[model samples]
Target: MNIDDMESLDEETRKEIEELRRITPEKHGNAFFAQAQFNLGATFIKNGNIEEALEAFSNIQHLHSPKLYAAAQYHIGEIIESNGDIESALSIWRNINHSDNPEIYAAAQSYIGFVLFEKNDIEEALLVWGNITHADAPEQYVQAQFNIGICLSEKLNKEEALLAWSNITRLDDPELYAQAQYNIGSNLLERKHVEGALLSWHNIEKKDNSEAYAKAQLRIGNTLTEQGDYQGGLLAWCNVERLDDLEAYAKAQFKIASFLISFEYKQAAIKELQLIELMDDAEAYAKAQFNIGILLGKNSDIKGAVKAFRNIKYEYDSSAYGNAQYRIARILISNNDLTDYTSAKTCFELAREVFSYEARSYIRILELLEVPETKSFGLSLLDLLNIVLDIVDILTLNFSKYADEEKPFERKLAHYTSTYTSNLLLGNDKNNTRPSSFRLNTINNVNDPSEGQLLIRKLKDVKDNSFVPLAFDKKFHAFISCFTFNHDSLNQFRLYGKQDNKEASGMSLVFKKDFFQSKNLIGGISYLSIDNTLKITEAISNINVKESHDIQGQKIKNENDDQELVRRSVMRCVYLDPTSDYFHLAQRNRLTFFREFGDNIVIKNGTKQSQAEYEWGVYQEYIKIITEKFEVAYQILKTTYKEVETEINNVRFTLGSLKQKELAILVDEILLPLKYLIKHSAFREEQECRMIYITSIDRPEVTMEYGSFLYVEYEPSVKDHLDKIYIAPAALQHKRYFDNILKNVDVPVEVSGNVFR
Candidate 1:
């Protein structure tokens, strides 16, 4: 109630009470009169008339001893404490020794202890608080136990402090319990028992005290960061829910920004710092603006960075304002623009004026920045800011530097230019040179005919050699440059040879024994290398337009035995159909060639056939190279087959008959040559003996003839006639389907044992 309201009521009540005290009949009852006086004291106390209440209660003590007297004394002590007379309050409470009023006695003793604690008398406070053992005063007992822990912890008696906190067994008083636990955690953290400390903090219930809970979460993040688990620390900080404490929240956000900057996430760091500006905290807002200026300058947003620095008001944070001005000067000086030098000098002078006491120290550091030896210590931007913030009081920097804080981030330049200082740079160190590889030019030179002759002689005359299995060919011998062998059950292998020199780097070939026609072999080959030298007058695509004219030019060059012509290998595609006479004469021809003295097979043989698509697609590629204008050596392949010509049809037939069904009808016409040569070999051991026969001449009736064959039929009007057909394996279906599950439920099938075994 207002003082006027209480005075108005007190004046009328006082006159009536005085008249009743003077005119009351003493014979009727003095007991009734005493009760009426005691009630009057309570009314005075409620009206905030402390002196009058004391007088009324003191008069009752003379006439009679009642519970009202004890209540009045308790309130009198409270009024003295509220009025700032703590000593007087303590004395009054200490004299209230009424044994009959256990509640008042217990509360007065607790109040005396609290006052002693406020006065910094730790030993006396602890003793007085420990004396409150009233069973009816659970709240007082809990508060006393908590305060005792705080006193002991402050004195560095950690064990004793924790024991005192543990004595508070009251679960109903959540605020006191949480406070005690928080104190215990703080003590444990001081002792370097990090895990135990975090456990104790995590035990605090957030539902009880939200401010304390937020603090615990922030501490967890700081502790993790000190331990060098940076990512883990960030996760803990992110979980800190905003509470009543704006200062703690700002601190948490600032810490998050520092961590992000250290990890090179500069943009994210800037955003985290900017969050502080939304809060009402002037100090946090100024610090955030200073950091934002540094980050903007790093990003090369020069004007934006200057504006951010200039926006830092001196009244909010004098240190931040001074530091921002210093940065503005540093940026302007580094910019080296003639127009900005005058402004830069002005900024530096203003900064000095703001920090006059430390002005010389800053200037000395700036001079040291010019010395290469002192400047190249490689301190990061954040580190420089931290050192400046230190020894400056405007910034309340409380966190102590731990071991991880000692490590600074790597320095980095703002721009990637050659004419920059070596003060800061960021990137992993790597060697400029490429990885080392074995040199092979000296012994494997194609120009030396003696080397070629030696390789052929060794391959034909090796006596004690068993054919090394293909699977065991991963390792190679230096002497034997190239070798090949066929699988035992599959005779679809050919051994090709080549001089392993730089000249043969781009040339490739492929061969496969025809599975359908066991007595015949069909294959294709082409050369797709470009001969582009500065000497050539015409563009590469226009080099060999007329087939015969190009062939003649190549022949003339070969006849002259030019160095370039000597290294060029023959590019040809030789196929033997069953109806052709060469199929039966191949074996006899081979014997005759070997019988008539030794054959120079080294000139014809090359690397073993690994990818059939390379050789089979060469014809289609030759057509593509000239038609689509791909650069290739003009002398390699003279013929440029038209799309509808017989040569392209033949090439398509050979590739479509392979076991691979996906490439049956190559979709992209432009990919005929380049795509074919670049495809990885789909060769596997199980597929070695398999082959397919495809025909597009006519749509025939489907029929199965062999034990492992399946025939398919296509109507005449079918748009996508799939011509490739391979025989199915025993006990297997070629059709594909997905297993359906009802109600969109997933069913797992567990398969046991290895299939291969």
Candidate 2:
């Protein structure tokens, strides 16, 4: 039968072997009989008939040939060992009478050492192999020498181990030569002679496709890589020619891919990694998949990269598996079209949990972590409002001092009545009433006199129709209020108030010549000095806030005897109550009050007439406030304040300037009730964005449409990466409206001292 046909037909091959065995001459010391019997034993073992093979080898004692019997004993030992009977096989090999056959005796001795080495008796194994004299059996002698070196290396006797391996001069068999050279290289590496090791590894000629040759080639690449010659190492790994060891071949390919990736040959590296699946090594294949993902990602094939990483399977705490998960997250993030930010969030979370802190993925994930913003570039509308509200709170707290010290509207009305009655009874002017109301106006110049004139005209109309007290005149109020803090309040105020209440009654207006330059009023007292008194009042108010627990306390504290009564009196006059008639009067006359002063006070050096020469000075201090400062604040109210209001209820604000629609938007959609928000949220820029994060959820919209759910927007953007993009001030429409309203607006001031009532 043909060899191929015989290999496929095992029964026929066994029958032929049995026939040969039966027909062999039974004469003792007959070479043909011994050869036929040995062949039969080998065929039986090949057929997996270990019992028959063992019986055949044991019958070799009748051959009457020491060499054949010894060989047969060695075969019996191999069969027994193959059957996992290690001790029995060891005993059989040890008892083999190979004294007359040097080759067989040497092989038997080497087998004893091999079994001992496997059993972890390294010292005895070394002694057994070392006892073999290399006088005959070159094959066995070479093997014994190699084994001795391995044992010595295991014993850590580097010098003696190298000497033992180097003793092999004959190199007829390529496997033996490669094995010896490979051992020498290992010992050299152990001794730290990397270059010598490389040289020894390079000389391991693979004349046959042996495992040793494959290992030597792999080691050469490893040594070169250790020496920082990655390019050369990769080339050596690529040159690995081995069919006997698939694992080693896969490892070599993986190394080559890694090296190519280091050099940025991503496409080539990906191809090399892709070939690892052919090796069928689960661990190597997983590692290769991870590396291929990295390569594909580096090449900008994001989808391909994600697929590659997702393919890695569970393996014993596999670093590659963890790494693959991490890469998948990176691929998703880098895609940057996060239609659904939460979709990839789990991937990121899983990657972080799977990888250890020391893993490259873990470190990268940390670097990508979004830290909550403490500050921002531009304030959102709501954020700006919060700041304005905070400023208002501070100002209100300061104004509260006047509220406590000054007479209330009812008391002031009685005092004026008594004075009027006394004067009338004493035959004084019957129509005369002590200054019933007082005006505290902040004078600022307009850019165009016509603009100021326009404002004055508009103010008359507003004053006539409006009923709400204490018109804010955000433009002028911000300008003058800023000075109280030693800060330009105009630039800080973005709020606008508009009120209409017919029942509101009290109104007062007073004007004096040269108020801006002289800083002195009709009473020959310096307004500057009076302004100082107001500043002191504001300072005292701020100090009171810090010292007191409640800003708006129900019970008022009595003034100290040593306190400056005059300063308190003056500050009380400056207090424009939001609900009082005086406040209404001021709002009505606000535009006219502002027009009284020019935008700049031009003081020429040669001018000696101080009063007439000095005009309005440029109000650069508060110019920023009116132009666009409050735009963001307005937008905050306009956009999301209503939605915020429903979730919170601690603090409530009464905004004056907003229209009915704007007010509805605030209550219905934008503003949050203060209960759920931080107390000083308005003062904090971060709170603006934080609110968006809280309320602006991108829930996937589903509707009954055919079978699939329909979404209005696919893949909403992530909030973290988008913070900078949302940074914007109030809307342009609001600013334009304010500009138009302020340009021609005028406030009316009344200089009347008597009350008709």
What TM-score do all the candidates reach, one by one?
Answer: 0.44, 0.40
Residue 383, candidate 1: C-alpha displacement in angstroms: 21
Tens-digit lDDT string for candidate 1 (445-561)? 222222212211221233222222222111111111110111111111111111222111111111121101111011111111111111111110010101000101111122122
In the predicted model 1, the residue pairs found to clash are: 411-425, 412-425, 496-606, 497-605, 497-606, 529-633, 621-673
**lDDT scores in order:** 0.42, 0.43
Among all windows of 10 consecutive residues in model 2, the one with the lowest summed lDDT is 540-549
lDDT of 2 at 353: 30
How many residue pairs clash in all the candidates, one count each?
7, 57
